[model samples]
Target: MDADTLRAILDAQAMQQQKAFDAQAMQRQMRHQKTLDAVMERMERMFSAMGATPAGAPASTAEFVTNSLSTRLPEFTYDPDSGCRFDVWYNRYEDIIANDGSTLDDAAKARLIVSKLDAATYARFTNHILPKKTFDVSLDETVKILKELFGHNTSVFARRYAYLRTQRNDETIRDYTGLVNRHREMAEFNDVTPEQMKCLVWICGLANPEDADIRVRDLRKMENNPQTTLKELSAEIQQFVDTRCQALRKPAIINTVWYVSQRRPHWAKDCDFANKTCHDCKRVGHKKGYCKNFTSKKKPIPKQKRRSANNVVTARPKLLPPLVSLKSANNTEINVRGHFNCNFNIDGHEGRGNCHEADTTSLLGLDWIAQDEPLFRRLTKGAICNVSASKLNTLRTSLTKQLQKQFVTVFAPGLGRCVKSKAHLALKPDAKPVFGKARPVPYAALPRISQEIDRLVAADVLSPIDHSDWAAPIVVVQKISPTLRRLLYWTERRTQATPAPTSNA
Candidate 1:
């Protein structure tokens, strides 16, 4: 068997044997006491057989007078009924019993019986007396017995006396002082220093040992801690030692809900004290948090925006990759046809309205006549006939009347066709109808709209792009400009209708 297992088995057997021996001894003592009581009773019966009066029984007057007499009988009268005769007999009897009682008492009789008991029984009885839960004997009596038994000196007695006195108080400090003082006179006693004594007291605070005198062996524990200081040694000293110090033997990693003394297991692995050198982000005497190497290694790298493959960036793309793919797919078959101008030369048609030219410089200029070939083709196909010039003019007039009717309903008065500016025109016309100049609004009658718009924007009355700054100054006008209000309202509505950026993206 392994040494530890064998040791454990031996310990368990020894404990069982000790317990059995204690129980057997107690039983033997009880039996022995019963036997002693029986012997005492037999002796009392023997005394009764000899006509001795029982103790505390009333005696005759003659017996009282003769009770103190010598054992030698004096010459006496022979009257059987006389009190003197009974007294003479009783007095002689008492002296003989007194001499015999000395031999009968166990303390006196033990000298004779001591030779009869076997060595094993005697040894067991002597060695293992029943344990005393409390010490009924006085300290002085204990000292006297110690002196008689062990021949220990006065210093030991004095130390014991001091220890007992201190033990009577609450057990906080271990009585290391008392143990040292007791053996001071002895050549072999190695006294503890004051610092070591303080360390012991600090250990006592952590230990909470039972209210008993501390022993010399327990004070020897302080020798293990060479670095413990008097000021630093407190209950917290154990925590510091368990956490910070490296020792000859490995300490058990303990878990408790009380203040954590040790670092976590993972942290302990990285601990310098455990490894004896810093393994993680190595530096002397410390692990990562306090490591100089770690601090130096963490030099910041300056961030630079990575150059793109195209090396071009406008505004950040609002479209997703999948959306861009879908747009590309839909635009694959783009038509690049250009526009050409057309003229509507009129013939006889009474309902044909007079054509008016528009100013070429204005953004809404419409002097050149245009036609939609797709619409004309659809009209001729629906009629199932090719149109002659007069007939075509009549049809064209009818279509123009229809378009004008719809346009008047949709647009405000004095606002001409909403056409693209000449800068935006895609075609150079070959042939087109010409007309007289269209009338313009007088300059005097024009509102200072652009100046008013600038003033409104500068006052923080108008939003830059989004009308979302509610805290800005409110737009106030003496009289409402319907055109300007309409324009601003439509812009605000359209801006709000568009989707906002995805917050997560």
Candidate 2:
């Protein structure tokens, strides 16, 4: 009983009669799949009560390409820097349109899948299915929108962890059991690996260490054969892997001893590979990874001191912590290494501080991080950009109308008035007239600062003075604008801080 154990017992009785004809064809397809799932749930509730408009008014994919046959659908060139992977060129373009003996319809294969794609994926499929083109779509709605742009698929738990770590390395055993029977339905294996542990992970990937002597004589005769059948342990590991690849493709004759008088004969002069040593040049006659003066020694480069941008890289083993005496506001001696408490994380915001450690930095003071005004506006926030007047849209309207006609009164509107600076009311000996008081304004900014002080008091630049005894109190101060970050409704909130706040661009 030898032709590989009688062809693994006639392929385990033809996989037990194909598992009894697939359990009698799953009991005759469960009564025609429960009457085709109740006639597809009554044709999906009569097309959702007559809605997707499929009545007589529905025939346009250019009336199904009215006649085209002599086998065509081919043109599928790829190149997006062609290292091939768009789902392996869309499954070699659907296996060349299912072995193209063309019955071309679905609008000539949806205009040959958008005229064979690739000019940057047909410019992103004409910006995702155009004002309807490619003769207005079809081939199963353009291969479901080109499998939602470039068909990916992979997942079933990463193809069952790549078929439980597929192993046969230098390929053959019939292309490693034809890539484990084309991923055996991505290793679903009765869902969660139990057809005897998917034949013990395809017989532990043919026991790999370069087939450890075909795992001690052919996978220990099919791992104790509990009625063996990952196709008879892959035909008994392809019959001892074609008898160890035809005994490693033949020609091997090296039992060396031809020595006329070249010494070494007293039982090969103390054997043990003539006293083994050479762990890379310790010299003796080839042993630890055979090294006839093999190279790699390197280690000498250590120069580094040129530092200049106001040089300060002093960290060579200097951690003397608990010291205290400090004194700086013009009192000088503050080299304090003492003050402690610092826990503050920045983006993933945890807080606790009071720190100092200052032997030249690690201070942490910003008045206790500016007393957390929302973590000081999320650490001086500045990355949110649907234009906060990108400095007035990077202005170049003819260089902003040639700098607004060379700064007309400094680009004047209602305010910019400058007469080369001058101001003086330094009253002299016996000075007196002083009555300045009425100020309460901000009722939510009193009607927008009273319409910007009545447009600077109707642009005479202000002249409403009915009482002036050298008047002085005038404080409106409403300056900070860019609409407070555009009226503050900014929502994107992710700060659970494992140090993730990045924008240096």
Candidate 3:
């Protein structure tokens, strides 16, 4: 192209780029204004609720009002059915509004901020963000929101603790651990209450009085301070713990709780407390949620794991499937009830199936069915079996039966029929291969036998012979069964009936 033409093209491209950049800048500017507008709106609504103005109001009155409201809001939480919001109002001319020609008034901003908090976010902020250990609808609106989302239970917190156990590198656990320490300090020196102290100890697994002695000192220090009230101290400690806990890497630890709440079609009343017991109160009927005494000096138990120096060990978050009750589309109960091991039909045959069963160490031997020797030995010695996608159901069943049978025979005799020992029960030194199906018999004909051999090898009944990448041309498969013996015998006869190839000179 000519120099003049190239200059003109470059100029046009530059103009287009500048235009795009200007548009993005404008959009960003608009968004920033919107956020500021939302905050101002909240301030305004709060001011209005207090019957005062943000600016030009008596400085003393504004101070007194904001301080009082901050304290009262914790106790003056709005009922979900009340449709009441703790409003903060702002004067338009006094604050920075957007230049977007939209009337960025206080009401609009408040709505935007409130709207930004969707159901899930609101639930999280309510249940988890609050500082108190117990579930209280009467707490500060924000605190209530977090509690409502996370709920009062060890389940969510327990899973979080389990997740922290997986981080082998100390740094990951250290981040959260450090936050907890800070909260411990603040609660100790500020407004830590008996209830809050108990909850903190329980959640962090620092329940023992000896373990919590350090935290208890901080609480005593806070109580000695003449300035702080129970409300102020509670909020501070709550904020302190929540802030540190937020730094945790496993955000999804609580996400399962969120998912169960959203997708599972049941209210709080439907939850079953039968299987759980509170570590604090030691009550039989009530779980952690209804526990009145929050104070329990329990230190979190550290999980043990074998790891390399460079490896990061984190906790395994336990996943408990939500209780599912079937109901018709019309909201009628579907009467879905049965014992765990009711008759379940498998392959057109009635068989017993129990979803819940305990594992025994005896059946742990059968797990080596598909592992290399070293890996198998590692698992058996540790008595730890990694659940595989293929064998999970079978393994669960085998372990359950073995445990039940052993318990009955050893602990409670005459409870059930005892298993008779046989030669197969005695494990051999090379017992690993004995568990799996035997290798197939080999074929005589080269090309004809290759086809049959291909099937068995593909099915994993036969491993490669002498590390050859491809199947051997004239290999024979061993260990014939009656069913396969008949098919292979017929195949050999058919191949024999055909004449052999002869070379001509």
Candidate 4:
């Protein structure tokens, strides 16, 4: 009983101690697993709310991750008077934190919220809660303090209700409804259903009595029909308003030209001047009886005779050359010198004889003797007046060479005479000269203007002056070509003057 019993007892005690240790370790493992599961569930909920895939799924591609991270979060700076809503801020903050798919601790989130607070709010927190180490405060404690300090005030609800009571004429139906809804939320009034309250507010808020009555009738119809929603009613009301506005608009006028001749036969008699002609004066639009130049009386003058030696009459002025006539049945004959190859058909008739140049008088029925003298002389100038194509080509070549030598001086694209002429402004006896203010050149056109100025200077088209008695501002006009701008010297102010006396007094 001495050695064996003692050793057995020690071994049993040791085994019991080991079992207790194992049980404690197993309990700890279970607790750790529960904590891990809870965290995973929270993460899943946050990801779902943010429309992001769960962590267990494959990681998003690089582009997807980049787009998600690059999105800007809505910034909210706290206002003391309108104090930020805790729930709204928390939701936004949580989403922004989740954008990077990383977890943030409560302390870090609290610090971020404090950082966004306005100076007054931050001061209030520091003064009321933690003056020293304010950021060290927990998120839950900060949130609670903020809610108590800046949460909905009873006075705000009263003000909202007062605003709803007073309706404005210019306010739209949508805005009026929104205002009512906002107040209703703050007041937390549960006396009537939301839809009923909205309808009542809408009817009351309408400035026009007729519009209110119509809306009330529509609401009654909606009440009878359970499926119709308030949103649909609002849309219908907006549509009616738009249609009424269109109806109130003035209609466009259309002008049409009507033919009176087709409408009535009497129209021709009314517009008789159109076809009437004057017979006495040999003109249009009047009869012979109305001719102003016609005379009823006639007078005669005496004639003188020619006499001898010193008073002898000279020969009469030379008469014009007689027109030559040719007979043809099917074709017209044109004779230039001895050539008669220029015969052409005329009124389905043909000629049978060869005509000389002297035999043919009129050219295409135009009588050179009776026609303009200068034109006739030009038509009959040189002996070889009708030159061949080869001779004409030689003349053209010589003329082109001469033109090329003087092209720049003759064909400059500007006011050619204006360049040599100095502008003279006529002024009234008492009028004073006006010096115009110089306009600034635009930044985009500076380079182009500089280049144009340089070109003008080089061509001696423009020159700089040290001073002048009169100065006019330059106006730059843009052209179709981007490189070119038309610069004009505005002289309206300088040239315009008072009217002079119409007649010498």
Candidate 5:
């Protein structure tokens, strides 16, 4: 045979085989199609009888019931009008059944359900299904009957209202959010209700609206970002609540005024006082707030000596000076490091002020403050304080007082005179009396000199005569006392020097 004819023969056989296979497949498909149609029709009728749609088709959504499981639940103890969510309990019941480790048939399950029902429930179920037995119903139909009979059909509007009204109620934000979501589920709030909407709902239902500023601030935060998710909102709000709880638990400084008010009669109405007496006032009606003998006043700042150093120990200021670069008259920039409130004792005067920190030398510029402000007073005696006369005088005066106290007779007041012996002036024979003319005394010096002469004469230390051949000029010097400048009498007359010993005899 020719190659082309052989090929044609082979093609024809292959085509015939393919057609046969196609026909066989079509016959099998037709047979299976008939069976599927019958099964579907039967299922449709069964679903129709059961008042439900088949799982393959969309049916009216069944309402769910909720039950309070405040305690652990027992078997099949369902109450129809319990106003609780039934789907969750049903799932839990299914779990319980699944964990039973036994394959229970439809009749067995139905009978078990009927047997588990209370007497009242069993009677009610029998009456509801009168003229028919529970065992005769399919397992699915029995479950459906129990659902409709013992479960509450939650109203969409009512569930939504409850979701909207859900509040924190002192519950944690997580718990509050869960409660709201559960209600939203019952309300059939699908994903069409965005998370943003749920977040707004959560914010609106904050338990204590007037508790703090956090809620108002959080609302403002959400206003700026309308796309905030429930997770973000919950997380932020939870963090804020945690911070507030921590602050509340932290110890606070005792405010005396608040403390006193707490014990006040008007404030302490809740406290029992009939059998008690106040130790402060020793009166029954007396209140702690009105007591005048409280010793718990704020501690007074201790007095401290003034220091010349720029840095000092002080409290941190609540409001600090802004970091400003200061300029001197020469335009030298001075960067401020920090600022604080300080208590200062400058020149023996106490003052409180806000001080700035800088590396440059500190200056109490009169330009900064008003001159007439009369800050700290100046030194009373400003005669070169560098001498430290008062400090040395203190030591000398203390010692002098001690010596006078110890030897009262040896250290006499005014002037000291020797009663045991007298010194005789020994002069050379050629020594001559040199008298000097009296110099003119200024008006200021004249009063001081006359006062000194009168004091000396009163003490009998010097004798003043109306006429005197011997005379000398006196020098006037200012005294340290404030009363008057005492003058010192100085005579420059030459005197003979002769060594004379004290007569021990």
Candidate 6:
């Protein structure tokens, strides 16, 4: 071969190799474009199914394809535990199909639903429908079957009744009415009007029925008027409530004084001043100048008796003995038989003796003795001594004065007084009888205990029973000193019963 021929042949072979490589690259590009076209078509269908459109107008097929590929379907997965509501799943699947622009036939939709079902739901669907050779059912038919299997239709009636009976105390009228309407919708009652529903809800939801009849009448009138809205009716009801609250807040005028006066006479009006005495003549129904003794001068006007600093009769000062002895030898012992003792320490001086022998100087220093000298003398006089007529007269005057003063009337047991407890003790259902061994009373204290028991029984503080299932032993305890005894009803034994286990336990 020649050099020129060899060079031309080499060029032709290189060109042919390059042409073959170009043809293979063009084929690969065409394949890639076909794959991309298929992908774009699928994405466009998905975006259409999802109800989404491209953001802007595409100038070319490539741009349109690119935009379509960018669109995405919402991500959702079936969950059996989510709920058994077929409507919810159906709606979601419907959106998915629409977004994917899927031309799913009834059978295809059924298959898609089966694929989306969780294991349990899938098994259930197949077992229930496939057995009847109903595999190729429509979406609606599948939903119907599923609904019949899991639908809460049975509970709807119960819920409706419960809803109707519900009252609205804490919630607003509008909120309560809204709940009622929602429940009514769920109940799907036939031949019910909006007016009827509103009236039923109003009547049922009213917390206060003080004027229920009147309210019902008003509601009926409103129901008849087509122009009256639920809002207007609610406003009226709210106004009524406001007015009622305001009326209740007003202070009630109670004539307590008038009522008491009606029950009893006025104290001032009932008081009688006619028996008041005059200080001048010591006589009733007249003043000092108008006194009969002073006006008539029937007898020598008795001189007004004067009292000393000790409130003792100064007119008879010379008649009484000296209050204190000047010499120790003159302190004679005077024995008096009486319960009154004169053991008083006054002004660093001690008076220690019977009431009759009490030092008059010490008694005069004592304010109590000075104010009640007549009573003191009467109480201190020896039991065997003959009381003089004048002293007896003084005692009578003191007694009469005390009797004339206002005093509270005390009704004792003997006077037919009775007392009752406000509330009686209520024992629990599970209460157990408390049993305790009786404590032995001390031999020396037995008489005292018996006397105390007798006193309590007589006073109705304690009652004797022949037998009792619940018994708390009596315990004697010393109080103040060993000489004083108190009978105690030991309640520890009664309260120590084994407590029943609680619910939490």
lDDT of each: 0.42, 0.59, 0.45, 0.59, 0.62, 0.58
Which residue ranges in model 2 land beyond 4 Å of their true spot?
A: 1-133, 136-141, 152-200, 203-233, 236-505
Model 1, span 230-279: residue lDDT tens: 66444444454455447545779987686655665556556546545567
RMSD of each: 56.6, 42.2, 41.2, 37.3, 52.8, 37.4
Two-way lDDT contest, 3 vs 6, winner:
6
Model 6 per-residue lDDT at 266: 43
Best by TM-score: 4
Q: Considering summed lDDT, which 10 consecutive residues are worst modelled in model 5?
A: 61-70
Please give each candidate's TM-score: 0.12, 0.19, 0.15, 0.23, 0.23, 0.23
Which segments of model 3 are wrong by more than 4 Å?
A: 1-106, 122-169, 172-189, 193-505
Predicted candidate 2: what Cα RMSD to the true structure?
A: 42.2
Candidate 2 whole-model C-alpha lDDT, 0 to 1: 0.59
Q: After superposition, how far is residue 130 of candidate 5 from its true place, in Å?
A: 1.9
Report the lDDT tens digits of candidate 5 across residue range 466-503: 97544577666778896763766666554443222434
lDDT score for residue 208 of model 4: 76
Candidate 6, lDDT over the whole model: 0.58
Badly placed stretches (over 4 Å) of model 6 are 1-84, 98-101, 155-157, 166-185, 189-505
Candidate 4, which segments miss by more than 4 Å at Cα? 1-75, 80-88, 91-102, 153-166, 190-505
**What are the clashing pairs of model 6?**
45-100, 46-99, 46-100, 49-98, 49-99, 49-100, 50-99
Judged by whole-model lDDT over C-alpha atoms, candidate 4 comes out at 0.59
Clashes counted in candidate 5 amount to: 8
| lDDT tens digits by residue: candidate 3, 419-449 | 2321222323442221122345443545545
Per-residue error (Å), model 3, residue 115 = 2.5
Error of 5 at 104 (Å): 2.4
Worst 10 residues of 4 by lDDT: 301-310
Report model 4's TM-score to 2 decimal places: 0.23
**Model 5 local distance difference test score:** 0.62
List, residue by residue over 37-152, the lDDT tens digit for candidate 2.
Answer: 99999999988877866653434432343223212444343332322334455565575554452445556656666666645456566657767776767777777776656643
